[model samples]
Target: MKNVSLGLALFTLVACSPVSQKNKGKKYFADLLKDVDKIQLKFFNHGDTLAESITDQTEIDIYKELITGKRDPKQKIKCDSTGEILFLSKKDVILHAWFSSRATGSKYDKACVTYSVEPESYGSALTVRSGQDIDDYYYKLRSTANRMAQH
Candidate 1:
């Protein structure tokens, strides 16, 4: 019967489609942090200048945990960046984390950070707002950078 044939064809098409394969699970921003030995935290002074890189493993680990631990998925993608953390392995930058400034909060501000695998290609990457537990880390880093810049 045509009905049976059509049903079989549809089933085959659905099973072989790329969407079906890609839908195994949702990929989060934290997925890109794997195997990164050194994470360089570069604080931005109002998007004008970048402070010195923080390479200490202890500090880097703290930031890594704070950033990847909790995430509030954000639908809105755009934000004013205040700082970024580069996830590196063997001296090669693997991922870039662009975080919003505390001073530039809007009505919808929930403390967001965008993670990009490629440089300057955040439009297709994952952007997540921080949960209550990890919200102030961005501001804290910026303050630390400001103090460093003064010296």
Candidate 2:
């Protein structure tokens, strides 16, 4: 009986030790935000043109419309007095500008503009490794950041 109880307790510990699904999702967003913050810091530190980094003309055009208020049907983004824009993506991804209103002298500030790039189709979500998801998330985050910075 003692051995059985001890084994059960050990099993419970191991099972609960893993990260919860909800926390995993939060971490995904947090990591994505961190990557964006790094990119913005690098750009500002180097005084580089954010637009030059983007190779997609469609994305560039979309960004232009977003800033100019010619496109963006949702109109979820807004620019503050400091030229910072807040953009929220359809996938619940939130972005704040480098000098956006939400940034409080922190390096990891919210993006100025945020948006999502859904893969060309509307399909069921797929489950994959954390590493793989994180890489993809960073790429998308960077693209959004570049778009907002350019405009």
Best model number under TM-score: 1
- TM-scores of the models, in the order given: 0.49, 0.22
Put down candidate 1 lDDT per residue, 25-79, tens digits, no spaces.
2244446555567866555554645444546665555545544423234645455
Off by over 4 Å in 1: 1-31, 52-78, 103-109, 117-151
**Local error of candidate 2 at 111, Å?**
11
Task: Please report the candidate that would top lDDT against the real structure.
Answer: 1
Superposed model 2: Cα runs more than 4 Å off: 25-40, 44-151
lDDT, model 1: 0.53
In angstroms, the error of model 2 at 146 is 18
lDDT of each: 0.53, 0.34
Cα lDDT tens digits, model 2, 6-105, are 9999998888756343133434434444322111111221233222233234432333332211223463434322222233333342443323222212
Kindly provide the TM-score of model 1 when superposed on the true structure, using C-alpha atoms: 0.49
